[model samples]
Target: MSPGDEHDFRGMDQGGRGDDPYSTLGGTRQTRTRLPDGDAGHPHARRPVRNSRSLITITGVVVLLIAAIAFANRGGGNDDTASPTTKNPGAAGSAPTAPTGTKPVQGKNGTIASGFAHDEQGAQSAAANYAVALGSAEMFIAESRQSIIQATHDPAVAQKLQDDLDTAYSPAFYKNVGLNDDGSTPTGLTFVSRTVPVGTKVVKMEKDAATVEVWCTGLVGLAGQGSTKPVTETWFTISQELRWVGDDWKISSSSQAEGPTPVNGDNRASTADEMAAAVDVYGGFTYAR
Candidate 1:
């Protein structure tokens, strides 16, 4: 099956406690103690009475202090305290998903992003963007496929990869997927092929090479009335071996596998026209670490 056919198996009671401490420590007993009525000359005669008003004031102060501390520990809405996933909505995984805040590469080879950094982050960014290009609708078209391969693969393998893809996305393949021989949709239909990276991870990194895996969910099929192959979603992970060449990362080789798929939600399925319109309206992203 094509990459797109992957199975979609895809508040503490501080105030009350403070009062308890005082009460449990014989506070009430102490308050109830009364000096002899006539003991004016006693050594403790000058001491002021500890009233309930005093206890209440002290408890209020303690509660306020506890609350202030809890708020401060929460970082007062600081981004540092935010979960990594929250910080970078596109990034997945448990840790190290925080945004580096590095600007996306300014360079582009045709429509593909390039000029990645020399670090692990850059490798991940390159792998993710390359996955997007490889799974794009453009890959079904000859000229665009060549452009994508040239922009994504290492020079040594670009030609071979292009040739292989040309064979794999043959006219028969296009027809099987409900597209024309040249990768165009039939009249009144929209062909959709898009890969969205859910997260990325660096399996291994070195000075000159890196292996990164991009977990992706994609939409692939024709959207229109009477379509045998209606637009459907698939989940897969693309593992890309990258090389830092000429100040950028290029894919040396890559492989894909079925996903860590999610259970289907209970939402109503949209109509063909609705799906087509949504695809047309929502543009893809240039993924980055």
Candidate 2:
């Protein structure tokens, strides 16, 4: 199978750096946007100030509204929202999944990890790992791409899926992504396409089938001097419908959606050379949870 030929594999590399969820809960924190110091269209523009009494009244009204909303949703009966069971649902740094205490997959299926359990935990693990593989830099290479596809996809659809992906990762697509004719990086450039899974959730689980959503931040494009394609990051969620196949979970189908994206932080973007060195030095992870 040609590597990266799957239409579903497109946009896997869209990424940008932000607050590391591992280091802080601030990745998804919202902050107030401050206006620029100088130009207000008029150099002598002055801000209007409200009275202290009026400001106090507004604050009191805002607090009451919040209290009322909290009271209305206080019950554990809101089926429209994901309940805060394992953790506070929708909070930054919260795990959307419940713990199963099951260990990660112990075995390997070629380059991909294998030996997933047949439960919801196993399915979530499989989906997360598969997202990393399908969103990898290796997917642009022919041999490694085939290995990834075979390892993560159901055998029944692997060949056909490979053909589809082959058609999708055409020469034009490679050129668009700054790859050479053979999917190799241009001289002195480091092609960066990696998916870092932030969290996983089993949206729907059954005896033999599971729908798992893996929220991820990805790094894509190229890093090098004179390179126009600078590495970038993006937040997205890949939802995979997995089936228990041949004693392990395999992707039956998958799709990606934009995000529950967090606000961009104020961190200075790294230089291209620094990004290239980082990609070369830091190996990608075998994400488990």
Candidate 3:
């Protein structure tokens, strides 16, 4: 994929503002009128050409703009104290905690995915992506599945969850996904199983770990016309227990529960091509409060 496409995925996750001038075009600094206020040793005042009131007003506006931008990028998800916490809350005696709230941008500075600002959303985004990686089509394939499970999960829990999931994706489930009974892809149809998190919130927090619940509704199926195994959507909530392993948060354990789900909307469904194209064209987000 092109660099542009990769950038689109990053934008899709955060503000979804690919075209935002302030964010995209580098306008973190605000513009304001400058006044020549000679507040030096000379106490004599001179006639000011610039409107003092207007200068004050413009400065005030610029200050407000800067403050607003800072708030939006604060990474606390919002200013709310109850907003989700970043996995790493800084040392207590250090500067007040700056939280994480978005994904590590999968952006290539040349070819590297740009790192994200550490905050609450960042942790949740990483967790959500980890969830997707864990509950993916890859999980069925032994080697790839093992790699994914090992990479994202705590060792003990990975094994336990693996055992349980192995049973869940049984022969019937494979058939339904247009895969061979062993979860291999069938000819002409692409097998898909992805957990797309809609949003995430922190249920509780601890010094070493956090209880995060990702409310996800996923699409699972084959994306070819005239296929018996049509793509279907499923809703579930995955509550993950994340530990502050190394510097980043890792999933120590997780449990899935049937949703406090909403009823299906009356919106018309799209064709296979439409759905497939949409998935590739549009991207997912790093969710936060």
Candidate 4:
């Protein structure tokens, strides 16, 4: 099968669409409106007070309300479009020549008001990168795991995630990847845990929250010659529901399922030495909108 066939492979990546957990969250309702000004203020205007202090305070309040109204109307419905420059600092720093590759035909993370008018794009970029961080190799180390959980997941769900993954990647898990019974690597071999995303979809998006499904295939193995644990590739899917909290996006919950994987390629398998070399040679990417 073509790589594209396996792109949506497995129950993990192509599990139809999961239910939208926040289908019930309320958002703003846009109704027809006549222009605001000149429509007439309250019939009785305040005594036309000329107190300079009062004038300054009233002006400040009006400016704030205008700002709030602008925020609520952002990320316009359905054909919702937001400025990409605003949400992600990583993207902001990226050279414009960098490619975005393909675009998904479906889904959008709902948009919410970012008080900062320039934050829409940055928020989306952060959400995507945060997803990568959540699915990265660093999550395996205890310290990195804690840091990832704290940085990428909602505080409300971090503890539960820490507990669940601890149980999931137990000694048995380590053993499968050629690690010791305690999840440590033997000398001279490098353990690998990588989640390479084929594509990502934001079924529903918002500036403040998003439901993104990441179609991923991963590599897990110990790369070294004459090693009992040979490197292997596994296909699985990882889904993340993220919420913008404080200033960055955090995962609220996530899950994985087995592949819609296709047959392996006919290319010759690389030697352990070559495999180790490749790992060292290749660098990772920072995915974004």
Candidate 5:
């Protein structure tokens, strides 16, 4: 298939429109007449001023109300022990999508993140990071692909997974994606393959094993002057079956699927130089759940 054609490597390494409320409503024109200053019918005619005592009473009532409101809104007691719902009042009963202030993994096996906690959150983090590794440009190369598989997969399954990936990312496949036989870009081109995790979910969790789905958006293709396979974005979700091995989570198996895609926006596409520069300047993240 051509580079533009949709292709999938099975079990391998893979906004809202707002309506204008006034649009349908017709604009109305109104006529207004200014009455004489002293006329009782005048909408802007002056009224009798309140007495000093009545003004005082009104001012006191206003002050009291303000004080009452302030007192009622002044949350008391220790903040650390407050429930998520209590702390974020209107978000009650809703799952939190914000970060929980937990630090990302501090350990690394070479460049890959390792030493995940033995829990659901850890599984999710591992899955996300592994997805990034599996979908990287480095995975197109033989040596790095094997290294990544070994680092991310369980010991028992690593060799087989590496073999599968090696076959999947063959020299022919590299050429189809506009790379050299050894998975290197041509002299004047920059090959971009990067996977960014949008979110992660744990499908199933147990004491020692977990299933996680990592939603990702990736860029893949060659970027530079006179390139036919221009860099383009793609969305995919990778499901990882993880097992707790040693002290970290390791992928036992992995598979990929097309995304829960979004409607494309009308933004102008960037040039090859711009995309290449962006990839070089901006660094990838270490995700934490």
Candidate 6:
């Protein structure tokens, strides 16, 4: 709802401190250290300090354990009011409740999927799917981009939106993303831009209009030998305002903001060739709530 530039979903940009003072004795100071059980009067009496630090560490651990227990008890269901579950990953709970086996969508619209249900759940699904389509690398090309914009956006605004998107994905932008001036991948490289939805939430809902926020993890960049822009993952949240149009939810407008990012995993980084192979072999999904 703010005037923060609607199409500001820029790609992730690739991009610490210090030590001591008052060393009068310089590096040769004769320091007296005390044992953990030493008397307090002794110049080396560090025993009490060690004990205090240990106590503080133990206290911190206990507090965190108790907080974890409380958060787990709260469960993962959508909280009526704002809570840590809405923003923080692994804040609490086990696996999410199982899906109800309901169908995700009724059919496809020109190459894009569509025909979502007409409820909050439907709005969430539409947002997630539209995010995938809009975030795909295919949307860089003129034909595919126009198709995607027409398929996902409201018809009343699709033409203007398509023109805006065309300008946004200019030749300069394509070059920046390691694509050719015409949005084609360079020789022997595969440009990857895919959005995978982690979850969706209904931020607002009404009879014929709704707003849904979809949290997504995306992979973007080029993959292959001698590629400077190797694919990297980024986390972002997309908020879509949807309208029930022609019996299905269509995006009236949308905006994206960075993060809600979690700490990186300990997995080993794969080789560029391996990443290229994986991207070639693996396929993306049509995300749904």
Best by lDDT: 2
**Positional deviation of 47 in candidate 3, in angstroms?**
75
**RMSD over all Cα atoms, model 3:** 21.6
My TM-score estimates for the predictions, one after another, are 0.67, 0.68, 0.54, 0.55, 0.66, 0.67
Better of 5 and 6 by TM-score: 6
The CA lDDT at 84 in model 6 is: 34
lDDT digits (tens) for residues 59-132 of candidate 1: 22112211222222232222234333222323554446677777557588899999888887788889889878
Model 6 local distance difference test score:
0.59
Task: Identify the superior model by lDDT, candidate 1 or candidate 6.
Answer: 1
lDDT tens digits by residue: candidate 2, 1-289: 1211122232223331222221111112223344544564654443332243332221221122112222222231213443344232233544555555788687998878899988767887899899888778787787887888889887866776676556556676576557787879899999887778888877666667777878878776678898776665556677676789999998766655445566555455778899999998999878775
* Ranking, TM-score, top scorer first: 2, 6, 1, 5, 4, 3
lDDT of each: 0.60, 0.61, 0.48, 0.45, 0.58, 0.59
List all candidate RMSDs to the true structure: 26.4, 15.2, 21.6, 25.6, 23.6, 17.2
- Assess candidate 6 and give its TM-score to the true structure: 0.67
Q: Lowest-scoring 10 consecutive residues by lDDT in candidate 5?
A: 21-30
lDDT string for model 6 (1-289, tens) is 1111221221112100001110000111112344345365654422122232222221221122112212222232222564333332223433352575777788999767798988766777888898788777787688997888778877876776665555556676566556789988899988777778888877667777776777777776678889866566656566676788998998766544455667554355677899989988998887665
lDDT of 2: 0.61
Tens-digit lDDT string for candidate 4 (1-289): 1111112211232442223211100101112233333335545322221333322221221112112221222232223464342232333333342344433112222221122111333434544555456545565566676666566556776676566555545566455445667657778877665556665554455556565555556565568877655555544445455566765565565544444455544345677888888878886656555
Residues 87-143, candidate 3, lDDT per residue (tens digit)? 433334323223434335543222112232244544556567665665566666766
Q: Which pairs clash (backbone N, Cα, C closer than 3 Å) in model 1?
A: 9-261, 10-261, 10-262
- Model 1 clashes, total count: 3
Model 2 poorest ten-residue lDDT run: 19-28
lDDT of 5 by residue, 62-126 (tens): 12211221222223212344333222222344234576566547599988998887876678889
Winner by TM-score = 2
Q: Report, for all candidates in order, the number of backbone clashes.
A: 3, 8, 12, 21, 0, 1
